[model samples]
Target: MRALVTGANGLLGSNLVRELITRGHEARAMVRRTSNVEGLAGLDTSMVYGDVRNIDELTRAAEGCDVIFHTAAVFSYWGYTREVMMETAKGGVTNALDAAKAAGSKRVVLTSSTAVFGGSDGPKVLDEHAALVEVGVPDYFASKAIQERVALEHAAKVGVELVVANPSLFVGSYDYRPSASLATITGYLGDPLKITYPGGVNIIHAGDVAIGHILLAERGEPNEHYVIAAENVTWREVHDTISELCGVPKPRIKVTRTPALAAASLMELAAKITRKAPLATRALAEQTGRYFWYSNAKIARLGFLPRSMRQTLTQTIAWLLVSPHLTNKQRAKLRPHDDVLQAMRQAQVAQRLKSVRIQDLS
Candidate 1:
């Protein structure tokens, strides 16, 4: 199959492109002029330049592609105005569908976040059936909800098949932006003392998410939403895993919800004063102690398979070792953990070999 992937330089998009090529499919990677394509290095895919907001440009880029994967968005908690973020979200969908129709693409697979499933303070599992709550969700999430709605409506109106893949927090390679989760890990690496909070979230490898997107295109029902996730882990568990992987001390301080929110607010205030992005954001803090757990059974019906959290984190850390997003100070801090990182990489290789042997035996 030939496909066009927007935001092709991003974490999910880059991995999706790699997965497409690995599966012997052709991919046209549509990225902006200024996008960093380091993650796409050595990938055997055609590169096209276009913005998702421009229908004419996107149409030209989508030509000859059987499937159009819309994965472009302003993925940040700060540094973007609400208007720009919302426009990129909702407008991107409208343009992508239009472009799909204009280019005669068969289907458009949109990448939405699991944040659309309003999180709970407790461990309430969410699925695609959950309703999106707009009362107090972050702008990023609200925008995604709007994007999903627009895609569903527009696809039906324009006569284009649409499938949505809502993935949980990603933890795999090709993450050039490094994602917010990876940024947090980098912060922990920079500081010896790790701090934890009472929050939980679903984590999935970006590679598995890429597979989910492809499955959605191939076997997913039209207008269906699929949750692609691997593990639901608490913040403490997340930090502990990283600590073990890096051979560093585990989180020693557990900040409760209220104080954590306060800290996030202060950090945001300081960021504004310093004209920089904060490590933590109030939007994330507002979901403190909430369990963003999800069930991927819907996608499983389509033969979707996701890696374990350990496997995801292992690959992520291995990538982080060479990621250019890391600061010099952060790299220096991580240098001492080189032995631990190498050991983890070797163990991952052995585990994969064992899994392959088991599969062959079966």
Candidate 2:
């Protein structure tokens, strides 16, 4: 199949492009001219420049593609106004569908986030049927919900095939922009004493999420939504895994919900006054102790197989250690001793052996 992936340089998009090539499909990567292409360095795929907001550019880039994977949007929570976020999310999808129709693309795999399923205060497991949590959702997540709604409605009106892939927090290598999940992981890795939040989230490998995207395109039912997720883990568990992998002491400081929200509100106010991004926002603070868990059985039925969280983090750290995207300070903070490196190597080997054994048994 011939495919066009918007935001091709992003964490998920880059991985999706690689997956397409691995499956012997043609991939036309559509990225902004200003986007850093370091992660896509060695891939053999056609490259085109375009913005999802501009219909003409999208139409031109999408020409002759069989499917269009719309994954372009600002993923950051701070530093962007609500108007900008909504427009990019909603308008971007509108333009992508228009372009896809113009380019004769038969299907469009819209990359939406599981944030649209809304967050849970306890250990509730959400599925594709879950409603959007309307109260106090951050603009970033709200925009994603809006983006999916608009894409589905608009696609129906335009007579285009649309399948929504709602992915949870994904971690893996080739994160050139170093997505929000990666940023959070690096922050924990950068400081052993950093405070931990109370909330939990579903985590998956970005590569696995990429494969899910392809499967959605090829086999997913039109107008249906699939939550592609793996393990559901708490923030403390996430921190503990990283600490073990990096040989750092687990964080002793735990920030409860009330204080976290207070700090986030103050940061939001300061960011508005200073026109700078805040370290925490009230939206994130609101989700402090909540659990964002989802069932991936829908996608799993289509043969979606994700690695364990430990294996994902182990590979992530191994890549981050030598990634060109890291600055000098980040490099220094993430640098592990010989013992930690050996531990990671041992873990990788053990995981490989276990996978082989499982396969042999099956």
**Taking the tens digit of each residue's C-alpha lDDT, what string does model 2 give over 191-258?**
54678978788988899999999999999999999999999999899888887776677878999989
Best of the candidates, TM-score: 1
Which 10 consecutive residues of model 1 have the lowest summed lDDT? 353-362
Candidate 2 segments exceeding 4 Å error: 266-276, 325-362
Candidate number with greatest lDDT? 2
lDDT of 1 by residue, 213-283 (tens): 99998998999899999888887888888888776788998877788789889999999899988887888
Off by over 4 Å in 1: 327-362
Cα lDDT of candidate 1 equals 0.83
